[model samples]
Target: MRTAFFVDGYNLFYGLLAGTDYKWLDLPGLLAHVAHVQDPASHLVSVDYFTSGVKPELATRGIQSKEAQDTYVRALKAKGVQVHYGRHQLDPAKAPRFIDKQTRPSRQDKVDIWKLEEKETDVHIAVSMYRLAARQASLAEDGRIDQIVLVSADTDMTPALRAIREDFPAMQVGVILPHRAGIERPPPGSLKDYSHWMRRFITEDELLAHQFPARVPTRKKPAIKPEYW
Candidate 1:
């Protein structure tokens, strides 16, 4: 099977990589390994990673964090992963205040906060996946993509999978939830409904084995792993 991977970077990070030492990941290698594990005949032809640039002002390590993200992106690009960048939108918003686990959130009791949202990523992923499937539908049998694997736990992508199943019945859809093995998270039923197969969790050993080296040489400067990572 000729397979292509569409990765939601934000979802993958928060779900699996947050506060972990495996931040310097070799995305293509990891996905290829996962694909092969699922099906020995699976061949990864493309990897599209969707993400937004880090906002230096709001990042925990400030500019260093932004620099680290840039370095990682460069490394991914060097490895032939096609990266699509969205943008961060920071705005003033109001939401119900959280009191306690026993207390219900009341709309009347609200707090003003900075709402940071990643824009266009979900739409981009959906559109890109659909477009690829549509284009492949017209290609010769050997050139067409047999499977499209989504690396996200977000339910927002459910509709896209549903549409692909409807319009391109021959195109197989697979979902790889980014949840780590130790973390207990229910797989979204909606995503599973649209996908032919769903891989619920990634083991820590897989991540450890698929990390990039300390330094990846680029066309210009070498992309170095962050010291804090």
Candidate 2:
């Protein structure tokens, strides 16, 4: 059996940011753990880590290291995980903001452009899934890899999930929850029971071991902006 993996870097990163103590994890290293789950019967043909580039402003917020982020992107390529880049879309008013006034407070909501980057995971996954199957057509020509695994909880991927099964009929789909360690169930879909499979295997213990070290500590520099200047 041959398998290809698809991972959404943005979703996966925020997942760890919100819930885990580990700030960063070795992207490619973590995927290697998935490969370990396979037996001699299965071989890894590709690992696609779809992500958006970090913007300059948020890069200073300590969410993650831009340099290390770039390094990880490169490392994934080195390790054979195809890197798919896209611009993140920023919706106006991610949350809410308030302003003070003499009598009443002014409120405003605006797009958070600082974090926006290309977002095209769905397209990347679609193209990759089809290409992988197209490759070596005679080998397993089902228009999908032997086993298509995605590390996501997104329902957006349901279309791809359905197409591979109904169209190709030979490909298998599996969804793995990268967060919650390994206790969450995959979102319901129309994929066939045998053609599509779902599992939760990543654990907090494994996540900790694969996480990147805390970035180099730095002190805040004095601000040059004048108060009400």
Candidate 3:
């Protein structure tokens, strides 16, 4: 049996470690843990990670932590995070404007974060979901793809879930809430189809058990300072 997992990167990271000490939970490590939780009967058939790159303008205000984010994301790619870059839209109206003071003119409402939004993270997720569902349908038509696990809460995925249930009658769709283990689901209209929802939360202990701390493995401190001299 085969299975595919789709992840909303920002959604899972924010929700899971919002206030937890596991601020830097190991990305690759967590997926391994999830694979184990999903099924020991088979190796992770395919792991697909989807997310948009940080916006250009947010380079300052520490909005874009490309170094650290990339480090972690790189690890995932090495272990397998098929990242898909999304487009960033700029709304000039959002840029700061100010009235002149004297002389020529002066405007000082300087905000560097020009734009920020995953314009298509959800769309990418939906596409992947449907693709996997189609794969499952093909499998069902034959006989493969046992269990499908999705690590996301965004209701946009509801339709994909619906299609899987309706089309691939043989596959099992499992929803894993890395953070919203116990939170309430979105109200009715918000989620198109959730009648067949099967939910479960990832326990804190589980997260702790998978911490892949971000730290340099080998680094030595300076010998000593000569301020006294």
The lDDT per prediction is: 0.95, 0.59, 0.60
- What is the C-alpha lDDT profile of model 3 across 83-166, one tens digit per residue? 666666665444444445544333456544445456787878777776766765444443556667677767777887777677
Off by more than 4 A, model 3 = 28-43, 56-64, 92-115, 136-143, 180-197, 213-229
TM-score of model 2 vs. true structure: 0.66
Give residue 132's error in model 3 in angstroms: 2.3
What ranges in model 2 sit over 4 Å off? Answer: 17-24, 35-40, 60-64, 90-118, 134-144, 182-195, 211-229
Ranking by lDDT: 1, 3, 2
Compared with the true structure, the alpha-carbon lDDT of candidate 3 equals 0.60
- lDDT of each residue in 43-109, candidate 2, tens digit only: 5666788888776556653434555466556545544667888776755434333444544432455
Better of 1 and 2 by TM-score: 1
Structural similarity to truth (TM-score) of each candidate: 0.98, 0.66, 0.67
> Candidate 3 at 30: error in angstroms?
3.2
lDDT of 1 by residue, 15-40 (tens): 99998999999999999999999999
Better structure of 2 and 3 per TM-score: 3
